[model samples]
Target: MLNLLSGFIGLVALILMIPAVIPLLGALNWLFVPLALLGAFIGMLSSKKGGQNFCLIVAAFGALRLFLGGGII
Candidate 1:
């Protein structure tokens, strides 16, 4: 159940992240990173690795975008 929830949230974050990758829109990642982190935290409470791994990868991408944009773009 928790894993399912985490996966869903991660999917949503991934969807939102798509636009944030734009050169001038990278600031959106500020919102995405925390959401992804929440999903990751929830995934961590679950018993499986799938959801956790998914959320972690999403969060990593978000963080990378933020870093590339210098925290604001």
Candidate 2:
């Protein structure tokens, strides 16, 4: 489905966009948070199954980030 495809693409974009675009452009990370959130939310809301998958993906990512960074969100 398009939802699934879009969500997957968005996730890739969310993860890769900053690392790929920020350094060369001298962009700030603060500006990227909204973009990442928007992409992840829209990507997650595309379909029922995609929503569920996105929820799981978010949880996993959060846990990993928390553990690795050892800080509060």
Candidate 3:
């Protein structure tokens, strides 16, 4: 489960980095790619709480992009 989740996280981050700019947001989308990879590793290697924490981080960032609206520039 950990490995699968980690891979998925990285994949999602990479995909998000593909678009080119938006009306309201900026180019901060690609930044989450590395972050997601790191979080995935942390989630796979650390304690249960640590994994949860990483997942929370990923979720929060994703939420920010979706809710607040951010773009790739």
Candidate 4:
């Protein structure tokens, strides 16, 4: 149940990250990274690794975007 919830949260964050990829919308990734990290934390409470991994990947993307944008684009 927790794993499922985590996955759902990660999915939502990933979807939200779509707009953040736009040239001038990089600031949105600031919101996405935390959300994804929260999902990853929740996933850590579960035994399975899948949800946690998914959330981590989403967070990584957000972090990469932030890095590329120099923390603000």
The candidate with the higher TM-score, 1 or 4, is 4
TM-score of 2: 0.34
lDDT of 2 by residue, 21-61 (tens): 33343233334334445555665556555633553454445
**What TM-score fits each model?**
0.95, 0.34, 0.40, 0.97
Clashes of each: 0, 0, 2, 0
Better model by TM-score, 2 or 3? 3
Top candidate, metric lDDT: 4
Per-residue lDDT over 1-73 for candidate 1, one digit per residue giving the tens place of the 0 to 100 score: 9999999999999999999988999999999989989999999999996888899999999999889889998
By TM-score, who's the top model here?
4
What are the per-residue Cα lDDT tens digits for candidate 3 across 1-73? 6655665565566556445235444345546645675656656664454544555566556545644553332
Superposed model 2: Cα runs more than 4 Å off: 1-6, 13-36, 55-59
For model 4, residues 1-73, the per-residue Cα lDDT tens digits are 8899999999999999999999989999999999999999999999997889999999999999999999898
Candidates in order have lDDT scores of 0.93, 0.47, 0.54, 0.95
Model 1: lDDT to the true structure: 0.93
**In model 4, where is the ten-residue run with the lowest total lDDT?**
44-53
- Structural RMSD, model 2: 6.3
**Model 4 spans with C-alpha error above 4 angstroms:** none
Score residue 57 of candidate 1 by CA lDDT: 96
What lDDT score is found at residue 43 in candidate 1? 93
